[model samples]
Target: MNRKIVVPPILFIAFVGLIIFFIPMKEAFTFTEHRTENPKVYYLPLESERGFQIRYVHSIHLSDVFETYEVTANQKIQLLSMQYEDLAIGLPGSAEEGETFSFQDGLYTLTYEDNVIDSFVLLIGDVDADLAFRYLNKEINLKQQLERGKSYAFSVTKLSYYQMLRGGNLNDNRTKAA
Candidate 1:
């Protein structure tokens, strides 16, 4: 056997195997299926036309990677309709007092008195839904039970901060102008 030929083939096979092991597989290649559960509730401190709109808290959840459900004060599940329209724009369905829209990736916007406020984009994914909901629910429930007035303390997870910082650069200029 020619040693040179044998060595080269062995090296090539090892190199290919290493590449396959190190390279991340695309989501399309993933065999696992994912479904988003109900969103965890969170208290969103909103400042709107209404004076100190803290009473209008929200318990938000994502139905999937794209869809969201906002439980309003009346306990109605309002779907947050998402549309690209050139950007990831979310329009809440029939928002009233104390409603919120949350993405699976942790981006959230609170709607109070027909105005959007306290928008924060968080780093979340299909796997983080349970954590997101738990966090949101804890905060919202605490705020509701304690009746914490304006300027209450809340935790913006590291994931949420990173997501917001990254998405901040991609905000729609048209919306800002309008």
Candidate 2:
């Protein structure tokens, strides 16, 4: 009975659906991929009976380097200063804005403004620190041992604290291999 009006509405709905389907929605519904040729390392200052020591926990991928670090500590530990250093010995690219540093295999330094504050070294990478921490801290059941001199690619998965603590087995995990 109303063929003309019905046809127009159907065509409009189909056109809109086609537009939505063909549009690039990756950026809108996906997590930002933070790639890093060189990654940054993060550490926590741990006090033991022996003395004050730095425990390496997370590495911030260059993609998400933050100005401030969130640390969970039982006692109030003073942060004197923080700085970043390049550890890769033969890697190219210096620590410049928007530049990724290729770290040679070596120890780099992160100098804080105050010497009294404990400092840690972050190996520069394409991802930011927080994302790096999340990736590196994941508890994947190792199918095989990662050998020295070998590199592996991993996907970053976001996990809540409760999930991480339970599924990640983070309750008994240490920042570094003691």
Candidate 3:
């Protein structure tokens, strides 16, 4: 059964398994926690200043809040700024059509322009509200990586080196609960 030595080793193992399942390996910033029984996922790697931030602690104006997202070159999620100190309720009470509200020293920014955002759901604040996720120097304390009150879902995906070696990096603690 030597058909030219098994057709060049089965076409070089199917061209290296189609370049390791279609090459992509990066461009992530995902987090999904669906929970009906179990469903949690996490990811990071989306650097080169694609920017990201999520600081939280405003359970009801307990102060400190800071949105600031930007993964845009097409991946969506714009929302440029939102530093709060109290604008009441869920915040944002002014600046809409191409936003811009300021307050300096005491804090109360807002500054947004396009505001794309394709995914976002957050709800991991049972009470201690310290939820965080900043990037570019890494600072992920999403209530110690999700599952407080649970309700996560954020996005900016693109992962593929076979889904980052079948685990999808939560700093490689090896995730499962799909």
Q: Could you say which candidate leads in lDDT? A: 3
Worst 10 residues of 2 by lDDT: 25-34
Per-residue lDDT tens digits of candidate 3, residues 90-125? 898688788999898988898987778688887776
Instruction: In angstroms, give how far residue 80 of model 2 lies from its true place.
Output: 20
- Global lDDT scores for all candidate models: 0.30, 0.29, 0.76
The residue-by-residue lDDT of candidate 2 on 1-178, one tens digit each, is 7998799999999998867655533110001112435432212212222112223323432321212232223222233222234323332234444333342334332322322222232322333222222223432212111122223332222333332323222123442211
State residue 105's C-alpha deviation in candidate 2, in Å. 18
**Candidate numbers, best lDDT first, in rank order:** 3, 1, 2
TM-scores, each model vs. reference: 0.23, 0.24, 0.41
> What is the Cα-based TM-score of model 3?
0.41
Clash number for candidate 3: 0
When summed lDDT is taken over every stretch of 10 residues in candidate 1, the lowest stretch is 26-35
What's the count of clashing pairs in each model shown? 8, 27, 0
TM-score, candidate 1, is 0.23
Q: Which residue runs of candidate 3 sit more than 4 Å off their true CA positions?
A: 30-55, 58-61, 64-68, 74-79, 83-99, 102-109, 112-128, 132-141, 146-163, 166-178
Candidate 3 scores a C-alpha RMSD against the true structure in Å of 10.9
- Scored against the true structure, residue 176 in model 2 reaches a CA lDDT of 26
- TM-score head-to-head 1 vs 3, winner: 3
Scored against the true structure, residue 2 in model 1 reaches a CA lDDT of 95
Per-residue lDDT of 19 in model 2: 73
Q: After superposition, how far is residue 122 of candidate 1 from its true place, in Å?
A: 2.1
